[model samples]
Target chain A: MDGNKILVLDDVSVRYRKQDSRSTSDIVKRILGKSPRNNEFWALKNVSFSLERGDMLGVIGKNGAGKSTMMKAISGTLTPASGTIEKTGKICALLELGTGFDREMTVKENVYLRGAFMGYSKEFIDSKYDEIIDFAEMREFQNSPFRTLSSGMKSRIAFAIASMIEPDIIILDEIFAVGDGDFRKKSQQKMQSIIDNGDTTALMVSHSLQSVRAQCNKVLWLDKGRMVMFGDPNTVCDAYAEYLNTGKLPQTESLAATQENPRNRLKKNTGKRLAEAAVYLMLLLVIIAGCFVWSQYDLLKSYVLAQSLTVEQIENEAANYHRQIDRLLEVDTTRWDTGIFKEGALDIINEEATYTDVAKEVLLQAGDLSRDQYKKALAAAEIEAIKYSHMARLDALVAQMRTEFEAQPEGKYRSLMVYAYTNCDRFYDLEEDCENDMQKVIEEIRTFQRKAGQSEDLADRVWNAYKSEKTYLLSYYCVKLR
Target chain B: MTSDKANHRFLLSELIRRDFIKKYKRTTFGILWSALSPLFLLLTMDVVFGTFFGRNMPHYTIYLFCGLLLFNYFSAATRSAMRVLYDNAQIYSKVPVPKHYFLISQSVAQAIDFAVSLLVFFIFVAIDGINFHWRFLYLLFPMVCLYFINFGIGMFLSTLYIFFRDINYLWPVVTRIIMYASAIFYDPSILPGIMRRLLNCNPLYMCVDYFRQLIIHSTVPSLSTHLIMIVMAAICALLGWFTYHITRDKIALYV
Candidate 1:
């Protein structure tokens, strides 16, 4: 935490909860009083390091080995689940390419935007704009939208904006990977210039061992999130490069390897033993209940069959009706009217119907029915046809009604009232049995009126129909009686 | 520190101006696209909504655009801010400056667009022979306040995004939800009491409401109410700045 020591990490460790490899249903069952297995994974463990001002530290690690996590912890993006970090200085970081450039904005604007993001003001950006653009080598198309720029171009722009703003300590996260050969050379030069300035301390994360050797004075080797080796660039790089060549520790093992003592190993082993014991017990329980589970399967199978049968019945009846209509249309063109096709056809196709009676009818007329039906009635084809025709007819009727309603609004309202009155008349004809149905029609019309919020004249038209149509009136009374 | 702030400010202006020009560099109409994009969007929204929500809407497009222009600036700026840290992660990774500048830059860029769109709005109003009112200048008060509010939101989100990339996907849904909930297209007065209250809670509502009052109603909104709104904006900006300061170091890693 001293001024000279720009960054320090003491025994930093990161752990993430690992999900159990169980189905969602299994998890739900566990939630409902059933016990679930537990698992945890450590991404970083017992990592310790320090960096001083003027020292260029290069962090090298394999992908997913917690290099990024460690960087994140140091950067303050991630709080280490354990351990402590003390730092001093204004830290600047270049974590990714084009981290702040607005693609829709020009290079100049993106620079300003980047500057502002770094807490700079508009006037400040104005002064440095040209220099930043010049460094990026994008002056020719600085006014072009960033989206129009190539990936390499975007990277250069981002790099230029970042490097232009001088900070006490700068962090670069694999930005050297961006751009072409020429631009890469320029980027390298720019990085060297920053380092040469002497006031800025830097941390660079890269996979390029050569770059680390050339540019960095202090090197940190991170293996699976732990500091494997640290200190002089040549020594750390040699050890790291050797470790890569052979999947083993260096011949002269670094202190980090021996730092994991027997006590820690015992603790880790005990944790593993506990987890294994729990898994064994669960496996034993499964084996003990294997017989009971088999017996219960029969009951569950029956229940599933019962539910599936209901669905099958509906599907069969719809198909049968659809076939009947298709046959009728094929045989007698005069009997079928295309104009009657409407929008509720699909809904009708999906309706449930008692298919036992239809099956009996089909069996009785096996000899007289078409060859197609005789061959496929038992195979579900007949049922499918019936469903299709019924749906098509319903759809046509709905479509016709909608068209008429739109074409003649007043007449449509009159017709609705007349229908309601007819239902009312039927109340008496059916000995008050139709009362409920009549009342439902009146209620539906009232609901429509409420929802319409139309002018009084429109409401009057509907009301007049209700008054004049005797059936509608009788149906309304019948409904009241019910 | 003062010199640093000045240097940063100069750099920010250049970025914003570049951002503005870059938006239309390739198009045939070029800069005119700035004026036309909003116009096209306004007209399309008007026609589409006019068929369903036309009644009670006097000059529906104008009314909608008034609120839209202001809201668009806020929305676009905040949306860009969501990615500001990640987009400029390169710069932050290498340079050290206060992170709020990026949020401000995005807001400023949007302000420029808002300015261009405002001109288009007024031109249409004049051509339509809409009455002129001196009170229209009062609209600037809310607009300026709204700019700060956007900056605050941008700072908070950009910092949050660095930690949770998921914030990126969630942001658009949140914006859309707020858009409909706010009085961007409809009059807040027509909404139910509960809904109206809820709408008032939206910070953008105050800005949009003020814009409508000044431009359409030709009257000044309650000064105290606006002052309260400005205070709210200031609080948001402060909170955003604090959050960025606290989380600024972490952004490079998370991004």
Candidate 2:
């Protein structure tokens, strides 16, 4: 590792696809689906530079010279299409004025939010929060939404936040362009302080040749994405200044003497390879985990369902079973015969209907059954018991009611009807009984009405009850007869 | 490195807070809008769908509310997520923070809004005479599943939006179709089995139906239903993350 070098760009280049051309021919071509002719070009090409810790590099270039692109590449915003960039430590960037802030948020919230964006913990921000606000000289405006601040105020806060955090690297892209004179002096002092610390690297892109010449230890000059010179600040800045004033390109020979440093160049491709591997690994993990979860979904669902519902519904009837369910969740699910576990959970739910000693014995024997046959036998036993209970009660009630109705043939009477809707199929034990009982009751009521001949009013009452209940049971009933 | 992770978590919460504050800024109703907005929407839907053809069905308002609530949250979260990259271009374009953080933050803000509306929904359920059951707590499962699915869809849509402005017009129409197909107003149970199965394939419909199962019918959705939800959430999240990851390099330039 090059201990002194904190940032390295080895033959870095970035390409941008040109915005869709608006010409009539292009539109027609697009509409015709000919893939709108590839219009991408390199914005930055083969730009190699390295920054030692605490080295402040000034980048000077004319408009469209890819200066900002290089800053973005260095700041970790834009990825290089064809080369590698290796940098260590966090970067604090002021790519543009008011660029990274939510304008509608209060100034304080934006500061914390941005601080979080830069990977500073809230406790750290809380400690430095007052100092940041004070340095920006916006104590009163801190509570006001960020958009309400003037441009100068915005720049001040932006600079204060960027500078205050003490980042390992700072990228300033024409940040000095907007602020007032006093604020500029303050920010320059702050930059000087950062540089004097002798460990924080800084990259500033500026059109102001004077400040670049004064503040930067090294300078890079670019023209149309090609590096013109990279070396001592005076030599490169003077060449750039002359190019601007006289419209003459610097001499190649003169610039060759100040070529990029050899010692700082990165010698390994490990960083890029590692990043690529991590992403692929993540993709693999997502796929594997997905399949694993999918295959085990029944087990997972059983475990989660049992655990969640057991807390609320099964506490009183099957309190002892709670520990079993809890242990089912805690133990390794991969080893589970989920068929048995699921059946066991369903049987526990049917613990409510396990009134008879025979059913209780069957429930007790559930643990001994073969895993495959367990679900079916346990479910059948639970269902049969539940059916016997509900059906026997209904049959007895109907038999007694028939005798009473026959004796009171001339009297007006109100009959109570119970509708047992078998709508809850999830309750495995109750569904069959409810469905059979519902059909039987409906048939029995029809026959009784046919025999009573004078039961027209009773027919209307039963129809009303059916209409109000809407096909499912568990509703009020008003069966009347005369 | 630990501090960085902690800060990223802090960043997520702060960004969510910022989105929440921005959403309510200068509005008179403020947080109250979270509850009242859904109610107002429910009232309009009730007037249109409930009174006209739904009088015979018990608790039709609650049924409609259940569908509308989930759909609105899904649409709002995803719609906001689609714009997250473009809207916060100033932030992530310059900073080194993960772009999905902003997407998650915006989506979470919408979730908090949905949570408030859910409380109101429960109140409505009580008023409609639907008994609250132990299964109602199972809502957290679907809510979590819906969030991941929405986050996944948001990632997919936001990437599309960066490359194609056509999606700006296309997405609302897609959301409308999702709303109609999700059986938000009408019950899917009345539909033919194949049609209902096709509709249930939509993850949004599954989430809506989960709510109906818990709140309207007071039953835990079948374990298979739970499986579908988990599978859907996982697949959508993976697909969204994969697309976002693959295209992330190209995004900054286009945005």
Query: What is the fnat of model 1 with respect to the true interface contacts?
Result: 0.28
Off by over 4 Å in 2: A20-38, A238-482, B52-56
Error of 1 at A18 (Å): 8.4
lDDT by residue (B130-247, candidate 2, tens digit) is 8877768899999999999999999889987887767789999999999989998886656644565478669999899888878877788777678778888887887777778777
Candidate lDDT (C-alpha), each: 0.65, 0.73
In the range B1-255, model 1's lDDT, one tens digit per residue, is 345656565766665665566556667997677688888888888888777666766767678887778777778888877787777665554444445555677778778877888899999777756788877888788878888888888888888877666678889999899788877777665654446546665778878787777777677876545755766676667656656765553454455
DockQ of candidate 2? 0.29
Classify candidate 1 by CAPRI docking class.
incorrect
Model 2 alpha-carbon miss at residue A480, Å: 50
Per residue, candidate 1 scores C-alpha lDDT tens digits across A1-482 of: 57688788777776554652445575578789676444445677777778877879898988877776776567655555566778775566676676545556666666765666555656656788888889888899987777788888878887887688776667788888778999889888988988988878888899999989998999888776566788898998888788889888654344344343212432442355456656655544554365345334434443443345565764654456565655554553232222222112322344532343333233332212333442333233333434445434434544565566577776444455445443433543555555455555556556555766733343344344444543333333323322
DockQ of each: 0.15, 0.29
Per-prediction TM-score, chain B alone: 0.90, 0.95
TM-score of candidate 1 on Cα atoms, chains taken together:
0.50
- Model 1 spans > 4 angstroms off: A1-221, A232-482, B41-65, B71-100, B125-134, B148-208, B227-255
